[model samples]
Target: MMRKTLIIALGTGLAVTPVAARERQITPYIEVAQVLTADLTNDDVLTYTTLAAGIDANVQTRRVQVQASYRYERRIGYDDRLADADIHSGLARAAVRVAAPLTIEGGALATRTRSDIRGAAPGVLQGNVANISQLYAIYAGPTFGSHIGPVGVSGGYRFGYTKVQAPSIVSPITGERRDVFDDSRSQQAQASLNLKSGTVLPVGITLSGAWVRDDASQLAQVYEGKYGRLDVLYPVLPTLALTAGVGYENIEISRRDALFDAAGQAVVNAQGRFQIDPNGQRRIDYNFDGLYYDAGVVWRPNQRTQLEVHAGERYGSFSAVGSFTYQASKTVAVRVSGYDGIQTFGRQLQTSLTEIPTAFNPGTNQLGQNFNGCVFGAQGGAAGNCLNSALQSVSTSAFRSRGVDAVISVTRGRTNFGLGAGYANRRYLASNAGPGIIIEGLEDESYYLQGYINHQLDTRTSIDANVFANYFLSGFGPQVGVYNIGATTTLNRRFGRFNAFGSVGIYNFGQDQQRSITSIQALLGGRYSF
Candidate 1:
């Protein structure tokens, strides 16, 4: 089941309308701005004027939804560091109920971003430097489910493809630029059956299983896994339920060269050379098989509050999951969630897609909803907001991560405010001794905090402000920790369909025990929307 939120019109004042009754809308806008920027570290100042044109369009109905944004900017001034480019960022998701028991859904996204601004482990990339990158991803699947005399059955197959384009890096040996990229194709199939006993019995039973495979071309990595679980639930009360479950999972990795000799002897490849097997295939590095069980409680005292908590043992390790959401009032809401899981990087993306339904906001693009601070601070350009670093690719390391996130938002007559914080820690399962290893695997932790406020000063004027900070730590790495802090403020005035805005921002980025780089930017622009 998926949850849907009502979309609210932003910037433009409009009443919320049901998707089924609303017509498609498209707005074309253009902005001419003068931008002045300075970097404190190099004491360099650059001034430029830019002309940008973009379009925003959205269509929503009972069976389909689409949203997209595209902008092209041309810079005219004396600045060797700036480049004129086209920026495309958007997400489109659609689901069609083909029949009573069948539904098909799919989504696609394209993004232009920078590596360093994305929160990847410091040693994950070759030079560990932030550079521009582009990502294109798409997934589609069909689900079939229906009630058959109190027994519900459903199954689906999802196929996904991801392509990443990263900036070229200079080769150490040749001193020439070379393209390094990551691309993967993956597929997942899952099925589940559940039986609910009405007044005749107090218990319900559910059985589910899933299989996944991923092939990453550039990294020469392949992963496959199988998982199964059986759950039993009892309704202790109308608002409370008890649950118990048992699960088993098996994971396998292929195309990985071993670090030892063939005779089971100790052989350390100091230079990180690859050793091929007799079958002309890379040796396996890691495998896992485990059985786990857990007990939990789901409590929903009322419509405004709900909480779920569970704990158990898996693979001889402790595991847990929990979440709480409270609609404190008509104007306030809060959510807290935490989870610990062992999964491959590809599977992580799949799981995130499942969670999107709960967080989806039609008013904003998919990236904005997922990486709020980045989209908010990088309103004018991608380079200004590196907060997307948290969503970086970690396919190089199969790992277990535990993380928690909390957010609260409030809305008043003319004001809106929000605050959020998150933390995550990851431990790699595979050893970092093989060839193509940029840096040894290490425990990595990251933290994020952001706050934002928007206020409508008058019928034709508004103001927006936001501040954010991010910190990352990794053990046994040259770049042990890196931190970033930034703040931005904007004021806008509207005259009919034309608007004028001014924004200023300050940012600081620093590596562990190193001198930080500080930058300041200001922009004044006018836009017309029609």
Candidate 2:
């Protein structure tokens, strides 16, 4: 399958000629909006006004690429119950070719999500500081690739840091409050040697290895992984090829034990989590070491279309992976990708930042911030997998996740349309040896679908609408699940360099028969781009 990490994608960058007539813009704009929100489930009402200024930039040159969307909002509430808030959300990534064979790449992401699965919805999440949390992640790395005769040598090293600001959240299932993800530091190093076909006995050969580490502050936990793989490629036809690989991996996760009192009860800290003892005995959470293998097929009949499918044995089990991509100019795009790997809350957010399109028309919610877990692309609307599953719940445990995402988008005439769907299931890994024993054998699953439409009524007027539904099933029981649904539309008109828009949206959340929260919100705003 087509797999590329920051180490591979940044260092071994794809070479493309700079577009002569690209749509590049660096627009700085300020917006002031009056908002009204009413609770549908309850009888509460809120009136507020937000003052925000942000920048949306997309710039690409022969050797540099960058895209960013950021907003800072200060909300003034008319009622004391409707508290004021400061909200921030943004995503940015950049790559630069420092030399002919050296590349530097980095990205930063900030998002707001629910502290618990039972929190307020993303759209109507205003004034709910207890249930809302903000997360930040940043990573930078350099990759070096050079050719020594017929052999290709590539290597890279990366460092990442992630932090989350969470408030006190109480669980309804057990009425227990605990700490979620606080912070973590990640590091990765990789190197590879490649020999092209016909230069190495008519068969392509590649030997690659990597080492990864993550240090988390929750329980003073640590994750270490080492893997090496040798791959072979043989062409059976001009457009078809067979590929196989065998690898050995050693992965381990460990954490310190909690301090226990005289009665054999774990001592609780101020955050409701167990008190971690620095000098206590450390215990293994998960350990795996074995050989893995996979065989796959690659098909490419044209420049705009390619398909790759593979089946393999990995993580001590059987697995399947594949990718299909089609892009025709800036009008049409189709993509389907699959993944099966170990993931953490921080790593998942970091990886999602790498998938954002460098050139895109940023989409925003009623409050002028991008919706949770979704990113717009150059293909009309959202043209890539949504990151909803990655930001859903703030579970700090490492887990094995398997998922698939597909998007088909097209722009024709003065209308743009797109459809996207994604599914993910994560089985958490925690041993019964320490404080982690509380969350052993847990699982979480999710599926989501989203659709968007944009039509021009005139040269200066347009209407944009989108609808989304996301369902999550927790591991607490077979029938325990939460549903998130929302729809929003905006009517916009442009006059010179100034634009005016109004939007309305409704958000609904249902968790089994225990509780439900529903709200409707509206906004009227204008922005001046400079």
Candidate 3:
């Protein structure tokens, strides 16, 4: 049977500094790849060739920092004998110190990726299929803060927009495709004031408040919320501190539902009846308003180790937050953390953008920066690596999640190794049903473990290998359990400004009660940098 496959990819990049002493650089790059794919199971193989080009630029100074990148890809498939697809991705971020005590920051991200529904549902998948959608998000805000005498004050207003082109999916019941696109816009304003800088107040006190509003189209869901919080801190000793915080939050969501007639067809009126909310009311399913409080201790005995632990009540539920970090030596480090939080689909994607290196710059390498440091350093710098536990796709509704992450990395004479693990439990707040799809309230538990090792054979040669396994469990209709395992090894040879590498990877994903997929691929490529 023919299966989807990405065969070989080759890329080259060039970097240039515009001015000698100024911290400004620009890089332009291009890549070409060949893929062998099948749109469905037991289908004929189709050969596809793709070409991509991008530019990355960054400027940094004492008072300003900006980074941006843009990429475009065009693909041609032999089955159609035409360039049938064009893909674009871009990200930009800027932070400027408008004044000594004031700053403005903004960021925007746009990406196009294959939708996860194709794999989650019962269907044959192809890497080069047209099941692609774009996700766009932008946020801008200004923050001003300063210390006057023995008190400090700060405030900011932020505006954000998130848009996703929800792809049509084939329904298991009707076997017909339907559209389910949605968009959301939100605004948030916050302010805070604190005391005890130099007033000998015995304990530091901070007061903060925020207001947020979100409006979503298509789903006709509107959310408004207000939050107020107060925190106090006291130093018990030179290396330890006691911390406590109390907060109140209230959120409201507009009602949304589909109305169907006796004929099993959606009812309609002059105001786009089938698509509009019949009765605008509040949706209790999305309500999460209540009072919460927490108390925690922070310990920082030295520069190499720090720990924080807190336990609290949230909306009548138990909640906790904690983090621990330890630098075992100059070449080893460890980190562990856990948190409970409420999140929307858009917010989760935004969080992933902050943790992952999404920039397309020539020098931006996630593995090299987080895992294989010894390749560029003498004794290898002490660096910590964390597993990315973010959801792969944006869900249609908001959810609550509790998760923990941990990682350990060590570098020795000529070898570097790292291990990481993460787990999360998520509860969806809403259910959705459409022409071809039905999603009920879901509670999902996911976990993964990954490890990597890099070894230098000689001055110009190195080998790196990594493996990971992920398992997911979900409750409700069509209760599902799935696990995925993948491994890859690569050997690299350096030749001044050019490098040659060969890699082989194997991946397998399967559900306990259904079909499974396994793939193997080998690639040989060269990269040149300037």
| Per-model TM-score on C-alpha atoms | 0.78, 0.91, 0.75
Lowest lDDT sum, 10 consecutive residues, model 3, at: 1-10
Candidate of highest lDDT: 2
lDDT of each: 0.57, 0.73, 0.56
Error of 2 at 281 (Å): 1.9
Against the true structure, candidate 2 reaches a TM-score of: 0.91
Per-residue error (Å), model 1, residue 385: 18
Which regions of candidate 2 fall more than 4 Å away from where they truly are? 1-17, 22-24, 116-120, 126-130, 168-175, 260-274, 368-371, 379-382, 433-438, 476-479
By summed lDDT, which 10 consecutive residues of candidate 1 come out lowest? Answer: 1-10
Q: Which ten residues in a row have the lowest lDDT in candidate 2?
A: 8-17
Candidate 1, clashing residue pairs? Answer: 116-130, 117-386, 117-389, 118-388, 118-389, 119-389, 119-390
lDDT of 3: 0.56
Instruction: Show model 1 residue runs off by greater than 4 Å.
Output: 1-23, 49-51, 70-77, 83-86, 99-101, 112-129, 168-181, 197-200, 256-280, 328-332, 357-395, 433-441
lDDT of 2 by residue, 215-269 (tens): 9887788889888888888888888888898888899988878777777767776
Residue-level error in angstroms, candidate 1, position 81: 3.9
Q: Rank candidates, lDDT, best first.
A: 2, 1, 3
